[model samples]
Target: MNFDRKYLVWALGYLVAGMCVGLYMAASKNHAQRVAHAHILLVGFAVSFIYGIIHRLWLDRPGKVLATTQFVLHQAAAIVMCVGLLLLYGGVLSEPVLAPVLGAASLGVLLAALLMIWLVRQSGRAEAAA
Candidate 1:
């Protein structure tokens, strides 16, 4: 299987952004701002970069139903987590409801990523067999 350098770049960018956010949070005194920045860096940059890497590296069946389903689930979770973070930062969502919900969405994204990796590995094995 061919490797994509773009995924590496994307992952590095996310790590850098997350680190920057950490620095900013360290300097800030406000709790809310720190929380918001942390979520943005974690979910927006970190999760997104990971997703890009997964998409670039994984070479599963082109039109498989499971592949499509996983992709949709992954994207959907990412979107929801991002939006939820934004809402929380904007003070539109209370922590009691929003934080847990966003956390759950992020978990879904993680699960999807795992499933995609498994599918890609299976496909690679099948190709080797053939």
Candidate 2:
């Protein structure tokens, strides 16, 4: 029910999907889905799990506005990036649209990453001062 648990669940879903993709790729001997498989496993599963762990460990403000911002931005960007990558890799989307979509998604991820860095730095300072 909590935000952290929600992320963990999402990560698990990604992990299952990624595993399925990997299995399919292996069985078919087709590596066209390599990009999607990697992103699904790394960004979707690994990053989300890491995000959940960070939330659980850093209990400064569970669902504060900044936390909410980071969560929403990161999730939105991840979805956008994953979808864009999938479409592009599968030739479902042309370069014109894919370029802008993936570019914006990358920027969004960068912003969210910066916010996380700031949070970690803040926590580090607090711990040091204590």
Candidate 3:
């Protein structure tokens, strides 16, 4: 429904996903997915949860187009990064081909961060004006 709830849900989902990865690593005794697991937990779960808190406590209009775009962009980029790392580490994909894809995904994450910066600035300006 609301943007804060959406972010919270996303965060929880990522937490489950990340924990699953961790569990698999423990079971298989193959820790090659460490990078992916870490990213999923930190970038996916922690960032999204913090975003929920920020939107709920600070943002007046968290459902704006830019905010929605930023949320989607960050999720997509994190998914891409996690999947790419999995494939790369599992030897399912070669580095030469996946490197550019991972680079683009990383760039998407940066863009999402930039979008969040803009959203925070806009929210601050709105709050000040009010």
Number of the top lDDT candidate: 3
Estimate every model's Cα lDDT from 0 to 1. Answer: 0.63, 0.83, 0.89
Model 3 alpha-carbon miss at residue 116, Å: 0.9
**Full ranking by lDDT:** 3, 2, 1
Model 2 clash pairs are: none
- Candidate 1: list runs displaced more than 4 Å: 1-63
- Which tens-of-lDDT digit does each residue in 11-126 have in candidate 3? 99999999999999999999998988998898889988988888888887854789989988998998899889889988899999899999999999889888888888999988
Q: Which ten residues in a row have the lowest lDDT in candidate 2?
A: 58-67
Candidate 1, 100: how far from true, in Å? 2.9
lDDT of 3 at 120: 87
Worst ten in a row by lDDT for model 1:
1-10
lDDT of 1 by residue, 28-54 (tens): 744555554565566556655665565
Judged by TM-score, which candidate is best?
A: 3
Which wins on lDDT, candidate 2 or candidate 3?
3
Record all residue pairs in model 3 with backbone atoms less than 3 Å apart, i.e. clashing: none
TM-score of 3: 0.95
Task: Name the TM-score of candidate 2.
Answer: 0.86
**Comparing 2 and 3 on TM-score, the stronger one:** 3
lDDT of 3 at 9: 97
What TM-score would you give candidate 1 relative to the actual structure?
0.59
Q: How much is 76 displaced in model 3, in angstroms?
A: 1.0
